[model samples]
Target: MAVSVYRGFHLQSAPNSTEVWQVKIKNHVLTGNLAAIKKSIDWWCETASLIDPREFESLNAKREESTGALHEDFNGYTLKNDTGAPNAWYCFFNGRLIKGSKLAIQKHIEAYLVAKQRAEAKQAQQKK
Candidate 1:
């Protein structure tokens, strides 16, 4: 099975500080096994919660908002706008909007893909 990974994050803007936290997954990693991915994502979100409780609350409140919560789709995870279009500036994942350059996201994505592929292969060999 092929794994797909996507990157996502949350952005917080305040008078004094602008903070961003993001995560990237390899292609099909999340989509191929939604349950496992969701659990991993939820765990990450919990970790983020320790950093800023308010951010977690904000995510919970806006859970219904397409861009505010984790989105799982064929194209990959993304932060949707009010119109339900993927936001170019940031992709929301694990309860955050990741703010970074395309290159940065791509690098993370590649690393995740390689790691996931190796892990899946190992699991398959173990099953045999």
Candidate 2:
């Protein structure tokens, strides 16, 4: 299960027109493992947070108006693309499409969980 994190911005060429943007983060495939994938997602989200909030806010506002609803803050995970005909999962951030297969997304999430566990373990050690 290879997994990776992708980041990009969404831009609309015109009102009610199609939006497009380039992914900033490079695509990566990790070993087949759910944990690895999850970790990737977590890491990606954290990294995205470092971006200027204004940029994200701008994108979110546009996306909300285009989609007709406000969305959760850019937590680095969202359904980017999905067709009812075929089962698929995609994650997005700030209206940018973060392309990845279901398996890849799952792995990214797992990676996050793993990182969390490690942090907890470290904290526990310090407490002693």
Candidate 3:
């Protein structure tokens, strides 16, 4: 059983005898198996109006995330794409975990680096 949240949606997967998956977006609640939930989440991520499916594709054409054939690196951290849908990613930073899109993890790493730099500068000033 695993519980994960994405874009304000809570997705809980319980691999029991029934293999049920429940999703909650705000007050809206949906219950179904893994396939059903994946479809629903994919729909929610894309626009309501019909458009080219290619438009939703990521800029990184060199690698397809859904295949899990490859992984990317960000700030020296390995970004394992858990699911192409909802753009879920698992970025490992010394066991620190972040689950989100590439941009989300980038922002997180940027913030961490900025804080680290500030702390180092403060320590240097104190020693002077």
Candidate 4:
């Protein structure tokens, strides 16, 4: 994935609050870390759409072994709009609007998993 396909929060009312700056790129408008995204337009672009992580787990019957909450909503910090809406952002590639925080978290999770895999592989090789 290109850098321009990722978006996330820029400014929040609180440390964990979801209210953020809104931005417009081309024909699509997105709300998040407006200044940061504008600085790195390509990387900040919305690339993929994501469903809520918890709902997905439940629908797939892939419950976790240990649990407090059944599902984890990565966008908890994202504030609902005036219409009580969880606003979304647009992808630079297709100009498709998507959930900003969820997509950003998804991208981070992907990067973390890949890094972990690589580290495990390296450690295994070093042991051999």
Candidate 5:
């Protein structure tokens, strides 16, 4: 079976009774058994989301040391975009992972800008 996420990543299982998933994120391919993959994804969705930014940095550093690659950190989540610009970003944290396309990142960035504008507007009004 093949599953698609973020329009840039796909998960496919090898034909036969194998429980391994071949997850393709742009040009990167990750092959993990079902149990490990599920555990990783579950951790990302459940545990990593609750981690503090400070603690996450420490944890991410360890991940880079072990994995030997730079993973961009965002609010405790590790984002990996090896497929170049305008592609999807694979987010991994707390032993879990997910994929998000450029559009997804843009949406988050836009939201941040809106929040900043709101905060600035409030500050200006208070100073007036």
Candidate 6:
């Protein structure tokens, strides 16, 4: 279907496939992502129709997966109540300032947190 009615995700036909009756998971177009599948499982964990990937060998996620985590959490970063700039968001990370719109501040915080986590993980691996 060429419609956005499917919640989470669904199968859709490829454009200019050069073949008849071919379909692929709609979100796979983005990669081997699993946000949609995880959402489906969240909604219908028991009664609907979802099998746990960890339990079932056939339902394996051999590639990438999305945890569906919210990116807007403060996560140790503090927000400043608009200091003269209209419609702007000021974010402070341990005293360092980052000023922008709300979305920009959130993006910055998410990127910082991800980088920090990666760095710590790498450091631990070096220790090992």
The CA lDDT at 10 in model 4 is 33
Please report, in order, the local distance difference test score of every candidate based on alpha carbons.
0.44, 0.44, 0.66, 0.41, 0.56, 0.49
Over 60-119, each residue of candidate 6 has an lDDT whose tens digit, in order, gives 332213222222337676665433344356766767877777667878888988999999
| Clash statistics: count for each candidate | 16, 13, 0, 11, 1, 0
Residue range 8-110, candidate 2, lDDT tens digits: 3222122332332222334432221223233344456777433332345465566555553222222355444333212255565335555555556657666
Give candidate 4 misplaced runs (Cα > 4 Å): 1-84, 87-100
lDDT of each residue in 1-128, candidate 1, tens digit only: 22334235322233333232223443212221233334446655666422223445455456546554333332365533343333443556446666454445545556767788999999999999
Off by over 4 Å in 6: 1-73, 83-86
**TM-score against native, each model:** 0.30, 0.30, 0.45, 0.26, 0.29, 0.37
- Once superposed on the true structure, which residue ranges of model 2 sit more than 4 Å away at CA? 1-81, 84-88, 92-97
Model 3 per-residue lDDT tens digits across residues 2-97: 887755667787667356777765456667665556556677677543322233333234345445533787778787874454567777775778
Comparing 4 with 5 on lDDT, the higher-scoring candidate is: 5
- Sliding window of 10 residues with minimal summed lDDT for model 2: 9-18
- Which is the leading candidate under lDDT? 3
- Top of the candidates by TM-score: 3
- Give the distance in Å from residue 37's predicted Cα in candidate 5 to where it truly belongs: 24
For model 2, state the Cα shift of residue 45 in Å. Answer: 41
Report RMSD (Å) for each prediction in the order shown: 22.6, 21.4, 12.8, 20.1, 17.7, 18.0
Regions of candidate 3 where Cα sits further than 4 Å from its true position = 1-68
